[model samples]
Target: MSDWMVTQTPLPRRRPRALSPLREHLRDTFWFAPTAAMVGVFVVWLVAQELDAALVRSLRDDGDFDTLADLLRFADDAKTVVSAVGSAMMTFIGVVFSISLVAVQMASGQFTPRVVRLFVRSRITKATFAVFLATFVLTLLVLTSYDSGADPLVVASAPLVQSVLTLVMVALSLLLFVMYVNTTLRLMRVSHVIARIAAESFRVAALMPLPAQDGQAPALGPVTAWVAHEGQAGVLRDVHIARLVRVARKHGVVLRTVPRTGDFLVPGTPVLAVHGGQAPPRRALRYALSVGVERTFHQDLAFGLRQLSDIALRALSSAVNDPTTAVQALDRVVQILATLSRRPLDAVVHRDRRGTVRLVQPVPGWTELVDLGFTEIRACAARTPQVTRRMLAGLDDLLLLAPPDRREPLLRHRALLRQAVERSAPSPADRAFGLQPDRQGIG
Candidate 1:
């Protein structure tokens, strides 16, 4: 029953695509690699210290170092052995940890590297601290177990315990990662929607073509001067067409015939019964005037569109918390979008089936309406769902008003409109109303 309820059941959510291999590699390289390396180095150092203690005690008990040189030589050998063993152990642990992390991410349905990167980018400082703390805790646990005296049971269980700890740490990391990633992505998507709306508004403003001040009036060949009487209706009471013709002949420009009053004169269309010799100044004036008029028309369209877009944007912003106001703003936006989409201002060129192209100038004021409409649609697209629904309803209204020929562009952009609607769901503030505003309002 709600206007927002285009469908009763919500559309099924699609599974997001997996991140590409290249993206995964880049994420790992940029975000994960440095932290992993640091942890690995620290772990190796701890292992080597433990190993050196064991070796040093053994060498001292054996009494193999009677001289300082010999003792130093033996110490060097012990250090090398400890370093090799520690390095290998650290490498093995790192590999296990990385594998567990990836597996947990895959299982949690957050396998995309884009998601991971989003998380990393959002909470770099927090995540960095987490990594440091995790490494320290893990190292303490390992050292504690080692110092507990290599009890057969404990030693045998060490690998399993390490694996379990790795899994737990990886799972925790992923949870935090996803939270940050989701938040970042949402913010980014919203920003993009807003920007798109703003751009459309500018496009509308560019439609106006105001005439330049430098423009000149077009020259008339075989010009005739006539005075009009007050309250006269197509009556040339005093001046005859023949007399006008004689005057035109006095000038080099000759009028073979005169057109009847009230004859329509289209731009660029030839007028009959007029010829001129050496009318360079007249030709120049005509060209300048034509260009100036075209420019003026375009400027007007642009200015109108800009104003319309601004109004829609302001209305949308205000409607955020107030349902009634929001609905009204949405309605206005829809009206503007529908008009713009239906009838664009300025001249649009289209090719016919015969492959010949011709410029089509829209009727006056049609351009301004269309520009305003498109701007409104764009602004609505970036808004919250409640606002979007109102916008969509407005669009539907405008569509109804549009001529058949103007519907194609709106239909073509249907997918984008749908996406905007989906993205712009009403916030908690919007849902306080019993019914969706659009559904409750006039169709």
Candidate 2:
């Protein structure tokens, strides 16, 4: 029998209520920024009111009537501007975001749904929403503080600090608007979107750098117990690896994860298998794995590969029939593959300070990643001479970087590509042209 087996027995259902998971959830949300901005703006309004009162008192005590008069005139002039901005801000937010969302939708439809997450998690998107709402709120607060019937000093206090703050907010909102427009337009372009995804994937690769080769894990005792996932079906987004290692060390057991970061989990799915001594509490082990509705690039290194593949596949589809986009995606795919070539792709083993193996987390190795990046594109691009040529070039480039052990997958893909071109291309000339490796496809 296999080392790990799926059993029908159900593990205890324990919902993950950890703060780390909660932080991760909020980090990806669109509403969190705006909500936090609202709370922050209210506090700023109170501070602005106090500062306005203090400025009025100081100016009155110093008998600086001329400067005070100038300030009031400036405030009056700014009132018209601020009021206009206040009223238009919300509508501006709606229109800008609506158009931006439409662009995002079109890009997603053109590329892949995974690209939406990149836009959502963008700092510019969150900053744009936060600044727009804050400007509108601050403007309303400043305008409502005015009173014509009140004394000159009372009215003077209203427009001092608050008016300045509102004006600054308006300026920030305008700047963010320009930036948002530029970003949205760039997002509409396929090259920018593909580059963004590849850049993010590169960052992930840097963070989770693999060793040159897999190190042998210390031997442990036999299997003792199994822990299964008992919750609504979801993707395994991330894991608290440190906590798992600690728990295993304390319990004197070895825990091996059955599914990888991007795998989907349903109830009764074997999540972890215990080896050696006593197993840790099922609750701790279950909570260590953060499962969510969808996969995130947070800990799932292969998510970028998945996204690029999706874009390439969509471009090659009959509905789109855009081979250039596929070639562009293939460009990034090869770049990522080249980077992964120098690193070891193997199961990650975590050990305690005493050199005892505590946890084993399986990940996609070289062959799997190679197949993932090439197989679909090769099959889909066989009929398209440009894409096939680009793919062949990509595979050859990867072959130079990949070590001896890693070259097998690259060689296999190259042969497969030649076979596909021979079958898809009618004439010998066409087959020969398709097999010729060109980094820029036809170019």
TM-score, each model? Answer: 0.26, 0.89
lDDT string for model 1 (197-258, tens) is 33434343333222222332123334343211222133111112223333344444433212
How much is the lDDT of residue 435 in candidate 2? Answer: 90
Per-residue CA lDDT of candidate 2, range 1-443, in tens?
A: 12221112222243223335557678789999998998899899999888877887788888886777677777777788888998899898998789778987898888898788877877788899998988888888888776544445545574777887887888888898889888888888999989998987776666552331333334556778888888778999887877898999888788988898989998898888899866677776667888888898776778888889999999999999999999999999999999778664556666778866788777778888888898888889899999999998998888887777679989999998899889889999999998999999988
Lowest summed lDDT across 10 adjacent residues in model 1 is found at: 1-10
> How much lDDT does candidate 2 score?
0.81
**lDDT score at residue 96, model 1, on the 0-100 scale:** 40
The numbered model that scores best in TM-score is 2
